[model samples]
Target: MAASHPLLAVRGLQAGYGRAQVLFDIGFEVHPGQVVTLLGRNGMGRSTTIKCLFGMLPVLGGHVEVRGRPVNGHASHRIAREGLSLVPEGRQIFTDLSVEENLVATARRPRTDDGRAPWTLERVYALWPRLKERRHNLGWQLSGGEQQMLAIGRALMTNPTLLVLDEATEGLAPVIRDEIWRTLATLKQEGLAQIVIDKNVKRLLPLADRHYVLEKGRVVWQGDSAALHAQPAIVQQYLGV
Candidate 1:
């Protein structure tokens, strides 16, 4: 069972781009070592929530907390220091940097109080040997799959407590998608908490401990796998499953 206290919490979160409001009273919690997902169609404010959590967007109302500490208005770097790291929607890699440079660019040892082992450059290369093979290649030289792997490796180098992946497998080949899923499963087994957003509901159902389904920027449903399985109607209604 997971701990009672949440590792990351977002309550009444509201945000938007410019004068357009996209989120309404959005809320959720990610417990230690647990895997959760934000489920919704495009333009449903899923990415907006992620942006607010990382302080990339201003919060209209609400708060985000990490390990019981408030960090809603904090900068992205501050959020990373609080143990959150993100693999954004697109595999946005530094086009000019080599694979090794990308991995080390944002790498940092965890806070002394963090009990997990540090994620070193060597560790990331070991996790994806293709990265090691392409270590000297510029990001733009990599194939789509290789760039995705590099993106994930870069995030891992942050030594995060909770990893947030937005459209983690977007635009990847089926084989590469399988590889990404396998990596996430391995990370879960290693007890790294995660918040994932993906369109592949079938793939997510088995992996996520809990799910929050968003509709028009509100949480229409929140439940575990079993509960989700029991309510196929809700899945069809909001998720178009």
Candidate 2:
């Protein structure tokens, strides 16, 4: 079980690619077992924020702490070892590797001190049985949905403390999208902390505990589902209807 503090916290985060800054004063929190969403249209700073959080980009200012340990400017591999796992915007799976190999590549023992069980191939297969059926297929051979599932399973194999998804659902059939949402709900029930970025408000609203809406690389609004539901104007103004 998580302590009484946030699992991941970012305050006044600033980062970019060298001279061109894309994020400004970005901030958010994801407590243990909490589901948080970063919402915005394309070209916003959502993906940039994820990169900075995962140490893919350098932090220009502010603080980023995971479980009270400051990880600002840490190396990406170091950050991963510290328990932040990212499913990047593109499903960057190893195209040549088979499903089982991809999952086993990053597998690790859960670093949790609590009695929670660590994720294993058997558990991942249980979550997405389709992956088990396609265990021998190369990454490029799977459909978009199967690839997404593999990406997610590979992350779980890392036994991360916080799961950050850049684009939770972008391109997929309706059935696949629904399965992804259900998988997310199951992860939430299993006490996994998650930070999701996706455009499906109706689906996200119910699943997320809180939301941060960004525009022009800054967080414009932050609130819970009920608060967001109470203000449609904010959604239409910052995010499209």
Candidate 3:
């Protein structure tokens, strides 16, 4: 199928910390109901790109657009309210809060025109049944996989149109990682657009619609899954796995 208008677009994005520039002319797009993976080894501006998108870092240059609306200079909260949600690298959850509370804390009613009701505690529980079993457990009490699920659930509570997951399956057991991947596949079936950062190319290849390979603060390659499969050398060279 032909790609549609991007739900999120990054054009000529440049960002840095203090005097050091990290990203150079970074650009990519994530269409509705599509999953886009940003692939790179450590310190190649992957996280920096995400920070710029969420306004967590100052943008030295470039523009970030959501649904074609400019959000380059907007506050992080404002950016999120505009239907973009980020699940940061670490499974950042409220340790003192109960499972249900954490999910409800970020819950937002869906817009009237959204055509679907906002996600409920029950729906989230269904996605991760362990959360339902530990509905009253604190964030710290949950295992890594459970915490990851809670983080994703919290983001879903916001009823975002686009979900950005930084290191989605970074540090989990093999089985847990499989569960996470299965959940992502389910979300894909439900038509959620996502920007995912992960190193598991084998799993990512099947889940993501497109891939962007970054090297030293720039996108070196961009293409669909089939194209990526045809270029294993490119993956071996840049990914180093």
Q: Residue 136, candidate 1: how far off, in angstroms?
A: 0.2
| Cα-based lDDT for every prediction | 0.91, 0.89, 0.89
For model 2, residues 57-146, the per-residue Cα lDDT tens digits are 889999999888899988988889888888877789999999999999988888766456789999999999999999999999999999
* Residues 1-241 of candidate 3: C-alpha lDDT, one tens digit per residue: 2355678889999999899999999999988788999999999999999989998998888889887889988999899888889899998899999999999987887643556556889889888899999999999999988999999999998888888999968878889889889988988888888899999889888999999999999999999999999999989999985
Full-model lDDT, candidate 2: 0.89
* Clash numbers, per candidate: 0, 0, 0
Which of the numbered candidates is closest to the native, going by highest lDDT? 1
Please identify model 1 stretches exceeding 4 Å from their true place. 112-115
Model 1 residue 99 CA deviation in Å = 0.4
